[model samples]
Target: MRKRLQTKLSATLPPEQLKKIYNSFDIVGDIAIIKTATPNLENAETAANQIMVIHKNVKTVFAQSSPIKGDFRVRQLNLLAGENKTITLYKENGCQFRVDVEKCYFSPRLSHERARIADLVESGEVVVNMFAGVGCFSVIIAKKVSQTKVYSIDVNPTAFEYMQQNVKVNRVYGNVVPLLGDAKEVIQTKLQGIADRVLMPLPEKALEYLPYAIMALKPEGGWIHFYDFQHATREENPVEKTKTQVAQKLACIGTDYRFASSRVVRSTGPNWWQTVLDIQVSGKPSKF
Candidate 1:
């Protein structure tokens, strides 16, 4: 069915727009599928342009291709239903990370949260990004915050390749080190008692890695941006859940810490919120 629709779109769209549209699909696969009765060439062009800009530094763009009736495509492209571009960031005040939308994979919301986390990091800080996808958080931090060295860990080879490219594109290749492996193992070996700030953006599995993150933090103090999704009903409290998890981890390690802050960074789905916890770790205080 998809192949048939692709054929029809090829026939219906103008050669130029068809090329662009086809290229968009080629990069993103069926992920960016559009459904429309009458294809809007102007809107398609705009979407293509946005993709090009987001993937400016990438060698290729990979997208899912689907046929859309003209009206829906027009509405989506014009931001009537909101933009469809992935969250590969391009510009920042301190550093820049040009996303290769085709090869790299990630949500736009995650990219924005990474940028915000980058802003909070300081120079010379030892930073570790667990589940670092295509080095989004690591590249942004290294590029923007001088003196900070980042250990970016990911299991995906494709994302690692783009991660390396992003480090160079952002001109922070020297500061950002890409580690291609499961963060659970890689972080344990490379970052024991060294990280000043840790980013755990893998919401679904971040809780499982809390022990490693706690062990990796500097003794005197450190911060963690632990990402997790939970229900956001009036009776639900994401922050409290995060605190409970942190307390459990602290108990397991027999270490003491205090919660600095927790804030909702983005919404993952209906009634689901993604939150970050800022924790400060310390040793037992001596009696006066």
Candidate 2:
């Protein structure tokens, strides 16, 4: 429903904790997911009830039980209110996504990020999403840009299953190709030099798979949408720091590239930010 559903809360939380907990309110499809690092809610159950009362369209509410961890990147959810189901249909950028919030990773916060990448895709381009969770980016890109072919890859079998269904749900079978395996291996064996553009959306694996991302691009070169996380104080620029680090690593590998776009996507923590770099890779990277 709503990414940030605002409402009046005074009794459950003090004035200090209200903003943090309120801002943490997130909804994917009809499921509302609440996540907060602070452990100071006076009446957590009451607050959960309040959400259901205020939002009639919310079919489910879950307290994010664990941090998004592991290779699968799935969130552990504890039912707080509403239906005891983790599956929902999330709509974004004129595209629909069928996702299991507990079994598969999905972020409503990245709705704009997804749209931004799709906008950069030119028609007839062949795209490869290195971390296409549930085929969101690939489906959206294929939907928005006509005549584009997207090879969607994911290692998680569960996510891949959902991805296959989502591609069908969206009716982009010809446009989006779902491949299940480790992206790096998949690229080396089958997808080398096949893409006009490549997307590395998973921040954790983006840097580790940088070389494979380069390999996926055409020899003449193409664009890469890279994501990473960086911590910066109020005085430091996280995006700049991330850019420098990536630049250094890419240089070590002799990957010729330049930034086409870069920005702080979101604040992951107090001083930490998730940054993205739209890099135009030239020629090719050194072979490992």
Instruction: Go through the candidates in order and give the C-alpha RMSD of each one to the true structure.
Output: 10.5, 2.0
**Cα-based lDDT at residue 150, candidate 1:** 91
| TM-score for all models, in order of appearance | 0.66, 0.95
TM-score of 2: 0.95
lDDT of each: 0.64, 0.86
Give the per-residue lDDT of model 2 (tens digit) for 179-286: 999999999999999889999999998888988998899998999998999989989998898788889889988988899889999999889899999999989777
lDDT string, candidate 1, 123-234, tens digits: 7999888778777778778877889989888777777877888788878866888988877788677777788988887777778887777667776658877877778687
Stretches of model 2 off by over 4 angstroms after superposition? 1-7, 38-42
Locate the minimum summed-lDDT window of 10 residues in model 2: 1-10
Prediction 1 global C-alpha lDDT:
0.64
**lDDT score of residue 185 within candidate 1:** 86
